[model samples]
Target: MKDTHKHQGLRNQLVKIISEKGITDKNVLNAIAAVPRHLFMDSGFVDFAYQDKAFPIAADQTISQPYTVAFQTQLLAIKPNQKILEIGTGSGYQTAVLIEIGAKVYTIERQLELFKKTKFFLPKLHYKPKKMVFGDGYKGLPEEAPFDGIIVTAGAPIVPNALLAQLKIGGKLVIPIGDEVQIMTLFVRNSEKDFEKHELGEFRFVPMLKEKN
Candidate 1:
């Protein structure tokens, strides 16, 4: 009972921060609140989960800052039961968020170590995806084409065309694009193969490196 109380208290604090920072979607707020951020972080850093900052998990990568995750998720405008494709699973933190919001998530991670780690950890959080691929995220998940939404956690020099191809018409894809500094951009698939883009704002993230399997 004490552990549960601690978890809920931490979640409420995060939700309050998200609200004050203009994260208006109640569903998004609740989803973020529901997922235990501490579970996705290192045990030594569990107390830091509610802070509005990113923390190193493993594999030389860091989980995204809370606001960044909320902002990107808000841009996606996820609806209940929508099919979501996530590129760069990282610590599986974003994946848990998507699942909490009732999305059927399919995630792809290029790094073998992160992929394996996320695969093991995700189920422990009760947020395992519908499908998880250990392959190049630049390729997207072609077998699971026509996803309702796509989110990329890493910064890329340019948006991968393959990811755009996987979006359903009227579907949204949120990604961070640039070399050193990045601008989170939103792409809307308007037709069979056409997409329109809107740049949100500047953000920083680790580069999305392709791993040869």
Candidate 2:
């Protein structure tokens, strides 16, 4: 409930750390800097908020590392008002970053604990998505199909075809693909049936659960 000068100072240090790690996008950096990440976590873990690492949140989900969030966001190259679909709305941290960067977001979460908490929590921080649903991330959000960019926060055993199909032609899907550990993968829909794929480095994320777990 409090974003003090001390928290802002820590966030600035975090922004510097990630920048040194090679995050060059100013808007992305500003968004990361603007969002009070400490507020998203429990009071006990707030001290770890501005660190360059992920920490546990409710329902066993971990808010993604600052570096990882910045890296995925940098990959998207988002523009203001672009429609973005986010899979795995854990803590709604990444969703807040996207909203800060001015993207219209539609997000889904499978963990009902998080879904319900974040559904209301995000707006309290004045970071609201266009839609937030409690559902499966693997299937993506079909009704809001053809997203300008889709971001999957959790690791997937394989790239879900449904997510690929939901992308607008020329839109990008940034997801981590693998088990145990994941390789960050980006798929850009060039046409109805064609996608350009690039495999970035590795990352670790909670499994993208299916159905209501």
Candidate 3:
């Protein structure tokens, strides 16, 4: 639907809440404010769009909480026009944020329903990723390797070695690692085989599946 004044106001309030929660990256916050989160969600959940909570979307997946999106994006330290590989396109809300920040995104979605739906839906919102693939994210986009950043939207049991290999030297990978509760993890590629890792705390995300549904 329409992004009304009320929607914008709610977004402003949401931005403030995330900011207070320590999302200091202005670019990330601006992207969050700019996206019409309500439209990305199903109409039934529109009223709670800016509440910083996750809601069920199609394909048995949940659109991530707004705070989680901001937190992961902030960790990426995005720069305009950088190449970003996003695992799990989900509801495409996170894809919209990456596009808003001027990254060239190549996003992968494993669920066939979500892959087709989000592939068609995103362009309607004027958020166009460089490439949208229906494939296993664990494999990553090998042909399009050397990304400036890679974001895994779901919780992984272990970091995918393929993803690490695809990152450009000095690029960053933001992902959550665990099953029941994930620890927000960041990896900075220092060289071909070396990485600097950091654990940013706990979050809950849908499990990252290997095969397409």
Q: Let me know the TM-score candidate 3 reaches against the reference structure.
A: 0.99
My TM-score estimates for the predictions, one after another, are 0.95, 0.98, 0.99
Clash number for model 3?
0
Residue 105 lDDT (model 2):
98
Question: After aligning candidate 2 to the native by TM-score, how far in Å is the CA of 111 from where it should be?
Answer: 0.6
List model 2 lDDT by residue over 1-213, tens digit each: 799999989999999999999999999999999999999998899888998989999999999999999999999999999999999999999999999999999999988999999998999999989999999888988988889999999999989999999999989999999899999999999999999999999999998889855
Q: What does candidate 3's lDDT look like per residue over 1-213, in tens digits? A: 799999999999999999999999999999999999999899899999999899999989999999999999999999999999999999999999999999999999999999999999999999999999999999999999889999999999999999999999999999999999999999999998899999999999999999935
Tens-digit lDDT track of model 1 for 92-141:
98999999999999999887888898999889768879999998899998
Ranking by TM-score: 3, 2, 1
Could you tell which candidate, 2 or 3, scores higher by lDDT?
Answer: 3
Which pairs clash in model 1?
none
lDDT of 1: 0.89
As a TM-score, model 2 comes out at 0.98
